[model samples]
Target: MSERYEYVPHHLLRRPVRDIATGVEGELMAVINENVSDAGREHWIELAYIRRTCGREFTTAISNVESVG
Candidate 1:
């Protein structure tokens, strides 16, 4: 029997995420896309969010996600 997995899109996320590079925190706005390697060993995803400090929007990958409020 084949195992089933749940797929959750990033755009639907209402939680906050911190950008690893910029150390910026914001609430998720949208998920641009998700990519997986051919071997299915690696994953890459891009997302957009609004900056909490200045109300600016930015798109980035490799961010740290925080629990939803």
Candidate 2:
């Protein structure tokens, strides 16, 4: 399960997707906000939730996913 979730503006939730970096494919569950900083500035990172084909789940940057179909 994810720690935080947001139904991002785009219709990304509940959509099938794949992580090209890891090759894990599944449904997009949610988008979570992550705080990052560099040079005294904070940034929000959007992580997309994925339910792996093997019954596992995790969150990765939204840019890491691609439409499965």
Alpha-carbon lDDT of model 1: 0.57
Model 2 lDDT per residue over 1-69, tens place? 333334575476788898878988899878777665466765668888898778789878888889988
**Cα distance off (Å), candidate 1, residue 51:** 3.6
Best by TM-score: 2
Relative to the true structure, how large is the alpha-carbon lDDT of every model?
0.57, 0.77
The ten-residue window of minimal lDDT in model 2 covers: 1-10
lDDT (tens digit, per residue) of candidate 1 on 1-69: 122222347643656767667767787666554554456465545555545657787766635444344
Which residue runs of candidate 1 sit more than 4 Å off their true CA positions? 1-8, 34-45, 62-69
Cα error, residue 62 of model 1, in Å, equals 4.6
| TM-score list, all predictions | 0.48, 0.70
